[model samples]
Target: MPLDAESEAIGTLLLDRGILSPDQLLTAEDHARDWGVSLVKVLLSRRWITSDQLYEQLSYHYDLPLVDLMEHRPDDTLIRKYDPRMMNDRMTVPIKESDGVLTVATARPGPETLLYVRKTYGPRVHMVIASHFDLSWSLQRAFREQHSHEAVFALAEIDPEMSAQQVITPPQILVLYLLLSIFLLGIAFAPVPTLIVLNVLLTVFYTGNFLFKAVLVWVGGAAQESSSRAIAAEAGLLRDEDLPTYTVLVPMFREPEVLPILTQALRNLDYPLAKLDIKIVLEEGDHETIEAARSLNLEGVFEIIRVPASHPQTKPKACNFALRYSQGDFLVIFDAEDKPEPDQLKKVVAAFNQSPDNTACIQCRLNYYNARENWLTRMFTLDYSLWFDLMLPGLERLKVPIPLGGTSNHFRMDVLRELNAWDPFNVTEDADLGIRLTQKGYRVGVIDSTTFEEANVSIPNWIRQRSRWIKGYMQTFLVHSRRPIHLWRSIGPAGVFGFVFFIGGTFLSGLLNPVFWAVFAIWMIFGEDIISPYFPLPVLYLSMLNLLAGNALLIYLTMVAPFRRRWTYLAPWGVTVIGYWVLMTIASYKALSQLVFNPFYWEKTQHGLSKHTANEVAEASADVEEAKG
Candidate 1:
């Protein structure tokens, strides 16, 4: 039975019986054009019609013959008499016995086999298990266990207008006002060397900060290098069976175009589908995507979780809703445009199982699939590769709280649930969660997993995404630092130093780098004589050394990251990353401004509209074809 013939026959039978409307028949024909499955299978999978409803419709409308599978039983003795070899040779054959019925599992059971079973076995055959490469995986588990009700209610309760209130006065303006007030007071009171002492103290504080950063980076790098070797050695001996269930949550929004691609990628994962619980978390209002998902008719292993419309329409909120329904022992998150390496989950699983107790989370390496899409993407990818693959692992090895990447983070379910999932209020939920985990005495480790995500290929899009991230980092900084003494006591000195160097370093560096760049530029433009004579050689030398050391660490970080990725060709992008940070500085300022005015307003970065490599376009097109078919 050819697919076209089977579909046509089914359609004709349904039409004659008045079971299907003329419009529905036409729709079925259109659906069958690309999909290599029967109309019945497609309809059933799509939830447009159910098995019981179809039978009822056929009986009433067409006077067609229908047999209930539940009432049937195959010849048990005959099934048991057949050898395994003989059973394997046939397209459809009875394999085993249970009670008085035979169990018939098939490789490619055509309608003829179904008809033969009905006629020969008197429609009483107990079970018909058709095994094919593209069977419609049942969504029974999704409906039974998924948190759709909670997600729906959550969406309704979500306040989209929720934003950060501007309480912190602009530091620049405040500093200037303080300085002016001090100058005015100085003219009147003129005796104390307050300004001189203040300047000296500021100089010392900055110098110490710079030195501390340099030392931490060195220590972090050494720790990471050693850890990598240990992981590699351990990886060699680990087996797949030892690993536990790994849940991958993919939160989607207006992502109809990318769903098929994501689906295909997940299907290609090396992990066992039965053990892998992949949750496709979608927003309630996204009907287009929901419909698109139904059409895919993916395996039973894939579940669609609808996130109710909630205020603070952030990714974390959606994740939190999905977390309620997740069934895996360990959970991981992937963004809409991610194409992680198939073995990435396995690596995390292996790492977690080997060191089960201490490790609460494993942050995988994230790079961009479309790095060469444009200058912005290329720079973005390089920066990420450096951060995740180099800096984070190093930070973790040194027993520091690693600021997690937005995606590809695997966590122990109980630990994650204990933390109440990601902060609904925090925009950069991943980073905030990482800090929170550290506070809870849980350790986050790094694995050899590589997840390739879409970089923001355009400047404006890049800015929006980066701004949100920076703003979130600022929020995390404030939330944790509110109890400074307690934070110090909790994480200890080294951990506190790591937080300052990594988390605080990001904020401070972005804020101050532009000032440093301006000074350097002014010096370059004017003659050496025109420069401030008061600025001594020691100050200049220290500043220069600080800049040099930062650059060297960056280079080493970049080199180490791509080496881990086996993408050594991209190592040269370290030089270009400095220019990228200039963009980050710009974004930081924008984020600071928006943080107070519109904290919850998500800076939307549009995707799937890139004019990158031909290969990407072709692949995307193929995905569309597969989805439609």
Candidate 2:
């Protein structure tokens, strides 16, 4: 019952029976050889043969009856005779029981499942061929969550008022109200004392925030020397036979333009198509994207998972809906516009093999494909380089809870399921999950892979995208802070310190940046004499340090970031990071406004706007291949 390369139920048998043409077989064989997939899987992927046709060929080859699982539902009594684990793990599902005989539909009739059925149901156990997808769907129907509702929970269910109140809890709101009330009373009652206290608090907070980021920047710069670069897996060292199944969840919404691009990019991946469970998760309403996907004539392996319309429609929710259908041992996410390196998955496999047992996820670096599209893009690229290329690895080294990027996060299927996958409620479910993973005594690592994405060039588009991200960060900060003591205990003091500095500091800096910039501008134009009346020497020194020293450190980090990728021309654009941060400041205020009004709103960043097309990426890929050649 072992899986044999020249099995009667597969390849040669189909050709022998004229079920497939010799040319088709040769093409499928070539794809199989290159991609490390079986001929059957390759044929299916290319739509050269339907699953039913393959099964019919299989049945003819094996001299066994072919059963359509969709036509025959398995009863509970017969299912209980043999463990569903056999069906779940072995790709075989029990179909029906007859007079002292049991029939089962099998994709692969493994020795273990065969033995179990024979022992349990006696020697009259009948084996029949069925398509893998059909058997899998049947197994799911037989045992898994019957409804999407069971799997994907909404924000309203977890917190009745969270989607309404945004991230600010009722208690936090009350506390804020009280604090504001007290502040008003204090200003009215004792203006001098109140002003002094407020100035001192602001000075301390700003100084600490500046110092914290400065240290992180320094640490990142230092960590650059100690690279966490993973060597690509040697082709022969890990054979295709040993490779585990991989799932790629690509969640898209109104992304019709990127459909063909995404499909081509994914098809170009070096991983085995047979082993890949690539789900193109689309909102049910996204007809254009769905139709576009269909128009591409994509391989059957690239499945379209239409997520049911639900309240708080988000990417994570769509991912959760798709997650149920995944058959991979490891799962990863890709954005609609992302073009990951061909060997990205292989590197992740290598990274996971080298990492410790506690490691649950590994995040790859993200950069822009159209980095030189415009000034805005150039600055955005620099900003991302600073964040992903430098700071993330530094954070990983420090053992802090790393906020995960939206895409290219590879996770162990078991661990992901244990954590209930992703928080449907959290807007930035990716980052929130990273924190959650850390708190649950798991670690996330950084891999030396990059997924290229399109950088938003338009200012209005940038604001919308940045605001949603900022809003999500605010949401995460509030959610974690709700149980400050518990979170501290879970992550420990160092973790708490990091969470506060990284999450809290990031949002706070953006929010407070404009206020300080305005003051600095006023001081620059009119001299310090006007503001010097209220500021003590110590406060003035701290303010100067926070403004000059902090901004200088950040600018330095931004400048050095591009050097990591040998993007020397982009390095000068680092100075424009200040302008970028100002944009972020504007976005932050917009985020705050939205938090009060449209909390659960997803400011969807439209993709396929870059001038760079799929052909450009394809040519780049070809160039890499040519270099290898």
Candidate 3:
């Protein structure tokens, strides 16, 4: 839709006054078209014209008074009559009243706000424009003190990970001791027998793990029914206004570079502006990122929530802090570097619409924007493709617990809260939440939509990121396995089997990869003749099958990961993941050391490390908008 006559006149007046030049106006108009937002939004976002300047022009053009609410306080009685939430949520403040007529100051004087004022405060309403900044400042000043608790999420008090850890009962501790004692006894008294037993057990574990994933790969490849497949067809059926209120929480750290593109991607979302409740969560201490967020001069739909400095400064903690203040029917999380496909939200709504009532969470696919940045990224892409594109769907299809990736997972607000939100102590809160959801009889699903993020392209950066993940996986395993029988009863046999295979298998792959590789090296040097006597015939056969078929099947899965994305050239080189596994093994050992000493330590992944910048992600977002246009 073109701008209304009044908005056009304001633009023309701004041009005439040289507040913003004609070239700026024309360029903003072009950008407005691309972003599917208003031209006023474009100009304001670019800082071509200040909010005060634009609103001043609007008030003059429309003959409405421009008021700054901070300068004029509302009647205490009148302010108490209406809900504080409504005023804050709508960016409106009741300024003055005469003869039962109320004058309201608002940043947005659109039909929605006007209708709300008229219906709630009676038809005698006078609407005046105000600078969005001043309106926000006034709202905070008037309401923040009374309800500061409502603004920040109380995560520090509820560290679910540690709480669960402290509750480990006597019986659970006894079980751990008994198992350890049994292993020690076997090793001390019967060394050769223990070696044979351990070798056979490990071989079976590897085999089952291999077969389980092989099934997922085959099933996923055969189905090829990704969540992205239906977005185009479903977009026509669902109007933007028909969608319920949606809140997207973006938890950013010191990522100054990606902020502009982040806002651009958000503005490009295919949702109604009034219903979009997007909160950019920033740490109060990070001046660089806070300034970056402030520079965007975002719309009323986007709010900057400053999180107080606290221990366990992690993303989940930040998100948990923002969770309560979010008033959305459905909510999702996005990273600072994420450039989600424009229709991703629509896809989540549709998926929720079609799913069973027990289906509470839907995880979207996450891929790297810098896939071709270097060798590290290419392997990261292949790894992600296998996990998100293939294995996750298969897990969901099999009615097993789906370990969620951090970004792009959507949830029902009530269900999320009922589960007590993310565990602030858990590093991989996404994965841990999936397990918790399934334990509570809620089903988690996989969607075909994707959010492209910046991949860690440097080896040290990759190791830091990978080690944190490994440490968390270890935490989750120990936390949940505190009561094994209860876990078995909750998820049933398949769930228990899957938990052991998936989580246990992942940790083992990193920790045991080097050990297995060393053994293989020794075996290769000495030949089977020297190694044959120590191994029984059955152990020898199982080991040989795992060495040949099991390892090969896994390598095959990585190779075909690119084929899932139709990146055929990359698929041919996926064989290089063998070396990638070595890196993971190294990180796994590091994670093991951390888990023993500093379990809650989160090695933050540095963003914007790739040669590619956020502009590439923004260009990709624009391309989607262009295709839709």
Candidate 4:
């Protein structure tokens, strides 16, 4: 159906003021009809005219005073009385009250908004025009404290068991104490036997971890092919108007240089621009990137959300704060240096459409664009390819809870909100949320789409990033394991083991590697006599077999990690992953220390450091210039 008559005049006004060319107007009008959106939205989405120009013309057409909410600030007291979310949804807020009449500022200065004002604020009311940006910013400012508090404490308050606010419960501490006491007592009374038993357990654990991973790779590699093609075909057949509004959240901190790469990548997505609600979520204090985004003069589809500084300054919290202003039906997060495949969103939508009703999230494979930048980058790429491309699909196939990758995990908006969004206190909130989703009776699906990011090229940078992830895994394990029976009942037996081998084994292997390596080195130097007492004949052979076979299986798995993406060159570098494990050991210790000392501290990974990113920035600049031309 056509918009009411006043909405049609928006295009006429744009054409009359020479802000939109005749061809541009015609194209926008056609999109408006096809996409079932208003002409003003189509024009804004096209970037043919600035928001200031369109809104200025709107003020003139509607005969309402144009007020800049930023300058003539809204009444905070009045805003606090009404629901911020309701105001945001209506795109209107009561700015001030004069005598008995209330002055309202609305971005949508239409009959609907006028009726809302009269109904909500009584008959004596005045309405003024404000840009959507101004209205959103004003709402954010008024509710800064409220939103910040909610972001930090929402999960903690509503569901304490799921929150990481309390790192370890008393019962968990008691279990740890009991286990430590037993180990100490056994070591004192029967040293040799205790060592033998410890060796046996560690060897068994090593065997289980590697075998589980190998099975995952085998299962995941085979599970996704035909479904991927089917999803792609369906995506190609999807109509533009049928696609739901997608919210892209790019949460950044002090990474202004690479902002263009992300924006350009988002623009390159095959989805309709008008159907995209992109938010560049930033900390209020990060004036650098905030200014950089404004300087870019992004189209109306992109909104800059300045998150208030709060405790546990993590990406999830920033996202939760930005979630309030989001109008999209689905949401996905991308990092500053990410370059996702153009059709990734479409693929995700198709995957969701084809999935079961309970599928709440769809995880896309993540790889590195600069995989060959350095040895560290190569190893990182292989690690990610194995995790996202193989292990995740395996988890999905086995009905195990798949820990979500850092980026490109599309979520059903209602489910995300229903779960109180993300746990701000958890450092690796993505993985934790994936597990939590499964426990909550929601399934997470995997798709074939890829989002290529710049891998960490520096060893120290990689360590910092890896350590935080490990720390998060620790938090997740402790949080879910607190209620073991509930977890077992919620996810079932297969999920429990997957949780153990996947989440538990990740950190445990790192912590145990150096100990076993030391034992192996000592045995090799002393001809096995030094530790012979602790390892009887059968146990010794089992230990050696676990060491050799486990290492070989892992190396083989890494070698084939990149085959799905045809990154064969990276396969050779997989042999050097032993060095990567050493780094992981170091990071694992760092992570353990942080978990004990500062669990919620997010060790920010510095982006735009690689030479590849520099090249991307240059290319992005050229693209901007060409578009301008």
Best of the candidates, TM-score: 4
Candidate 1: 10-residue stretch with minimal lDDT = 133-142
Ranking by lDDT: 4, 2, 3, 1
Instruction: Write model 2 residue lDDT over 1-629, tens digit each, in one string.
Output: 13346432476787887877888777777767755556666776766676667777767766788877777666755655555544656666678878867787777544565776677567988988787767665655554433356445543455333232246777888888999999999999997678778878877887776666666666776663434443463432666656888999999999876766677678778777778888898887889988987765556677777777876788887888777768789999999888899988887887788779999998998999888889999998998988887778768877889999999999999998777777666678888888878988999998778999999978999999988888888888887777677788888887898898788877788998877778889999999898886678888888888778878878887888889789999988787788888898999999899877888788888776777865664664454345334
Q: TM-score of each candidate?
A: 0.68, 0.86, 0.80, 0.97
What value does the lDDT take at residue 533 in candidate 3?
A: 62
Q: lDDT of each prediction vs. the true structure?
A: 0.65, 0.77, 0.76, 0.91
For model 3, the superposed segments whose C-alpha errors exceed 4 Å read 1-173, 224-231, 527-534, 614-629
Q: Which 10 residues in a row give candidate 2 its minimum summed lDDT? A: 156-165
TM-score of 3: 0.80
**Lowest lDDT 10-residue stretch of candidate 4:** 1-10
The CA-based lDDT of model 3 is what?
A: 0.76
Candidate 4 lDDT tens digits, 1-629: 45547757887887888888899888887887777777877766866788988899999999999998878998888888998878987889888988988989887888888888898889999889999999999899888899999989999999999999999999999999999898899999988888888888988888889989999999999999899999999999988878898999999999999988988899899988889999999999999999999888788999999999888899989998999988888999998888999999999999999999999999998988888788899999999999998999999999999888888999999999999988999999999999999999999999999999999988888899999999999999999999999999999999999999999999999999999989888878887788889888898777877878889989999999899889899999999999999999999999999999999999999998888887899899788667655
Angstrom error at residue 78, model 3: 14
CA shift at 335, candidate 1, in angstroms?
0.5
RMSD of each: 13.0, 4.6, 5.7, 1.5
For candidate 3, write residues 8-84 as lDDT tens digits. 66668888888877788787665555445555655555445556777887787667899866676656556656676
